[model samples]
Target: MNSSFGIKHIAQFILFVALQILLVDNLVLFGTGFCFIYVAFLLFLPIGISRMWLLILGFITGFTVDVFYDTIGIHAAASVLLAFLRPLVLNLLTPRDGYDTNDSVNIHVMGWRWFLAYALMLILLHHTAVFFLEKISLQDAWYTLAKILLSTLFTTTVMVILQLLFFSPKRERVDYR
Candidate 1:
């Protein structure tokens, strides 16, 4: 990848983590929905990134959040699970023409339907792993399921808004000779 792409991703990683720690962490809704915006960073990573790097990045992102949340690596494990399943999800969602090397997982590039499906599935999986790992019991399966579903919806909505507000493609000017 180019230096600019690398820098952009690094900046995004820091931004998402900071947002999660500072803002989204305390922004729970209905006592069930928790927005894990940091997962967006992992979900939006370059489509062509290798599996090994993706796994490492996943661990790093989750571990960083784990450190601040003091949740003893729950975030790390969930993030890693998200990373491990990402490729399979992509393959399942692949377009007939396939993805361009430069394509990203944003709405502008992938359209609302594809992006929503992508975000929802991954976020659901991430939240499921997280809440289950935290609860570690089926005794409160109903509550845990509620938390997972609500959090997935909340996170997916925020990710879509963030993509629309900030990650929109910049238009280029063309001059006819």
Candidate 2:
């Protein structure tokens, strides 16, 4: 990681970890589902970010969440999976040439459709991996799948709202150049 980017990355990761564990953890809606805003921290990494760095962030994010929940390696594995597939997801949705260095993956800049599809796909992948890893022994795939989908939908909603309010590109278009 570039030294400057490393600082920002760590700050974002810590903020997300704290937010997810402290606030969102208690904001459970249905008994079975809750929002996890932390993953978006990883999701919002710049398009040009190194693949390795993104994976590292994913590992840290997942591992932190796992530590809070007392699961063994569920978060780590799922996070790595999500991080690995992130580039693939971006490629599939927007393509490499389509994204600018400053362009965001959030709802506003990418439009409702691209943003929704991108977030939905990754959330599904991450949640499914985590949910199933946690349930490795039981193997009740249906129940696990349901939990993943439900929780992801809720979490993705929070992500969209946050994107709209905080990181949306509509506010400032100042050129970095």
Which candidate number would show the highest lDDT if scored against the true structure? 1
The C-alpha lDDT values of all candidates are: 0.90, 0.78
| Residues 47-149 of candidate 1: C-alpha lDDT, one tens digit per residue | 7788998999999999999999999999999999999999999999999999775666778878889999898999999999999999998999999999999
Leading candidate by TM-score: 1
Candidate 1: stretches off by over 4 Å: 170-177
For all the candidates, what are their Cα RMSDs to the real structure? 4.3, 3.0
* TM-scores for every candidate against the unseen true structure: 0.94, 0.86
Give Cα distance to truth, residue 137, candidate 1, Å: 0.6
lDDT of 1: 0.90
29: Cα error in model 1, Å: 0.7
TM match of model 2 to true structure: 0.86
- Which parts of model 2 have CA positions greater than 4 angstroms off? 1-6, 95-97, 137-139, 170-177
